[model samples]
Target: MKLEHRIGQLLLIGLPGPQLDLMTRSMLQTIQPGGILLNTHNIEDAQQLVELTATIRSLIEVPPIIAVDQEGGRVDRLKEIYSPMPSADLFRASGDAAVAARMGEIASEALRTLGFNVNFAPVLDIASDDGANNGLKGRYLGSNLAEVVRLAGAYLEGLQHGGVVGVGKHFPGLGDCALHRVVQQDQCSLECGDRRARALPGLRRSLAAPLVAVQEHSHGIIA
Candidate 1:
């Protein structure tokens, strides 16, 4: 591959709409990106999603990674096809790792059937404050570090067991961040240092899904 195409393979981008139309096809052919992360905008219903993903594959020789943020709560992209999934807190509230695993299994089954290979899931951030508007309120899986690790591990295990890759998200623990508010880059280490210990076990549990990120996108991650 050329250097330009090699660089293009590093990107994982979002589409503006559901279908892979002429413009989308052109973009995919040109970029040949490493992956495409599908959001609600890129998914309408099951049948449309299948056709769209199939078209994406047909556009390129090597299949591009297809991903979705189907972590339940506010981020369930497949909610239109599958029933609305409960937020992560509900599983924590249940205090049973099995419940979380079951949910992950069911989710992976659906995502795999819909032509997705990656499920950005099992938010590992600790739920510290309910009042804080960091965009991770309902998305957090545990009230503390241990709960996060155990339940998140169970969930990811289920996701992988069904053959869909599970990407444990927001590494170094993005528990409290605000949207569009850029902080000093130098301070990132200081901020993330405390959470690194907590994040490792979850990483070990879901090692199958390689963790990766880009620019700050949503307030759901930033405080």
Candidate 2:
């Protein structure tokens, strides 16, 4: 690839609508971004989504990483057309690794049918029972380090087995902080030394796994 094209491949961009407009087509034709992140705003239905993704693929030489945040609960992008999925809390509550793995497989197949190759999911954050204020909340796997590790590993395996890439998110943990609703108060900051120290052991355990990748969230390193 040319240097310009190579540089473009490093970028993962977002679209505004259900279809590719002229400007978007031109940009994709020229730059050929490495991936695209689809959100709720860009999806109207299953058919429309498939067409949109197809159009995007046709515009580029190599296939882009078509990603969506399908972590279930409040973060699903395909819920309008697909069946509602149980939150991560449910998986953790079940205490069955097989069930969690099955959920991952089901979610992955659904995404694959819609032309999505990547899912921003299997949130590995460990949140407490009183973590309603935490950014992860119901999306987290579990508070126990051992349970989190086992379930996340199984979930990731299922996702990959079903032909979709699973991305584990919010590294170094997000359980200690609330979701940021505004920027003025710096509520999103991860500067609490104690929280960082407390989270390190779990973070190290998660990093030891060869199957997972760190997601880019709140200054968290993507490994």
Question: Candidate 2 regions off by >4 Å?
Answer: 179-212, 218-223
Q: Can you give the TM-score per candidate against the true fold?
A: 0.83, 0.87
Q: Candidate 2, 124: how far from true, in Å?
A: 1.1
- In terms of lDDT, model 1 sits at 0.74
List candidate 1 stretches off by more than 4 Å: 178-223
Candidate 1 lDDT by residue in tens digits, 1-223: 8787788788888888987768878988888888888888888888999998888777755678898888888887888898998889899889898898898899989988999988878787666665554667788877666777778778877888898777766656556544344543212234553565555665565533333431232323322
Cα-based lDDT for every prediction: 0.74, 0.77
Best by lDDT: 2
lDDT of 2: 0.77
TM-score of 2: 0.87
How do the residues 1-110 of candidate 2 rate in per-residue lDDT, one tens digit apiece?
Answer: 99889999998899888888899899999998999999989999999999998899999898899999998887878889988988888888899989988888999899
